[model samples]
Target: MRALTVKGVRIDDTFAEAFGMRATAVIITADSPRWAHQAALTMTGFATSVIGCGCEAGIDSELTAAQTPDRRPGVRVLLFAVSTAELQKQLQARVAQCVLTSPGSACYAGLDGEERLRLGNALRYFGDGWQISKRFGGKHYWRIPVMDGEFVCEATTGLTKEAVGGGNLLIMGRTAQTTLAAAEAAAAAIAKVPNVIMPFPGGIVRSGSKVGSKYKGVPASTNHAFCPTLRGAADTALDPDAACVLEIVIDGLTSQAVAAAMGAGIAALVKLGPRRGAVRISAGNYGGKLGPHQYHLRDLTP
Candidate 1:
């Protein structure tokens, strides 16, 4: 495996190495893309890792005005969990707590034929248990009358084995501004692709985490290798020339999804990165043993 080097940092050729987990996709629509993304951003906030967030989620794709039921712009988001039971619990909390709370936002099951169900029924109780049920296209929907208006969402959703989290990457850049621009560029490339998500703010995170922790109370701690503050320490591992690092995280539920995401993310960043060799990209993993899937940055670009 090879990595693109910039500012003395390495863009590791190794993949994210994710595993199969149960997944669900949600469709959120609103009066405008602004509102739609508002719902999406809020719903997906703090959902960086499944270990702490219960589920990992991101904006899967954007829907054109013609494709939505409300004839408005929207975003499709996918969430995955390690266990079926955990996924069920997440469905209710994310929908009720995030999607439902966003004003003028309505959620639908992007995965329409889910044999198993969770949210629609449980959240209907939020309508004071007076919610009205509607059926369209042989699919059950719940109309939860709210103070603002009606909240229409799908009842049952499809559940299936998905790659879950098999794709991801980390991009490091010299300046915060440049890093953001490059990360956004990468997100723009991946945004239109199906079955993938950029996920975090600007589709990037400055602080990534490690599997174990030095503190007994904290199950995880910030990734020190990528940390700029600890760069000068003799015991540190970061390359001497590394200035700053920005991380871009990708989510894909399929091998194709993983490939496409890695491809777009790398290609876009390469085109937009700082010209003074100030940017570099890499992947994080405990080793090949840590994750079932592997993504090579070189292969993605090639």
Candidate 2:
């Protein structure tokens, strides 16, 4: 396929294929911002991919005291899963293990919808018959005893079925250094957009994968087509000059949020241009068979 040039950068005539997912959000508040962020970081750990981790989660944004239900500093966390059952399980487990154990931490609903997932309702059993239930300001909450003091959590949190996952951008460049810089810039820009999470280490992935592997029972394998070292031995998709590649995968509460994130990331790459940023910008897809949502590169390009 021919590549379209924008400010000396090549934009592939491709699209990112994404699929439907179930998502939920929760707020973890504490006496101070430090502990709140610590709990959020711990809860989101080892949750970069649904294939391995059963969920994809990240700290969506930080919240001020005025923005939280308990009037304390907090962090809003978002989790995505392939199904509602998996999302509900992850939410309960993470909150029980991470947030409840944190000092002075409190959990609350961060979203509102008809579908609800049990939060404190599932965890009140941990209190060993000492849990206290109360209704205040038209919301139900549970107070469970703990060493620090008590863990306050909402009865339930709203769930949204409109989440989109696997929206990606592939950055190919002449060197790893330039490619990494461009990826970082795109991540920073995407972080400013609300309701989306990158869900990868440092918001960048070096080991992008294809749908299947040659070995039996292996669900996925490395994307050898874009590997710089396999240029001669394999069917390559890279330009002759591209020496390194990086990918950014996104999950959002809504389809519009994902598209906005993609547009922001592409604009950041365009601002750096080809010399300092990516030589080519493409996307991963399975010939429109992977998912229903297709984010075209041309439409996202600035």
- Write one digit per residue (lDDT tens) for candidate 1, span 1-302: 55565344356656576677778888899988988988987888877778778988888877878887668788888887788888888878888888898889888777755366576877888878779999877877889998889988878677767655746667666666666677777777888778876656767777888766877888778888788788766355455555677766777767788788778777776666455333677777778886777776767763
Q: In angstroms, how far off is 41's CA in candidate 1?
A: 2.6
Off by over 4 Å in 1: 1-11, 232-237, 273-278
What RMSD does model 2 have? 0.9
Best by lDDT: 2
Segments of candidate 2 deviating more than 4 angstroms: none
Q: Where is the poorest 10-residue window by lDDT in model 1?
A: 1-10
TM-score of each: 0.86, 0.98
Worst 10 residues of 2 by lDDT: 1-10
* Tens-digit lDDT track of model 2 for 69-175: 88999999999999999999999999999999999999999889999999999999999999999997889999999998899999999999999998999999889
The C-alpha RMSD in Å for every predicted model, in order, reads: 2.9, 0.9
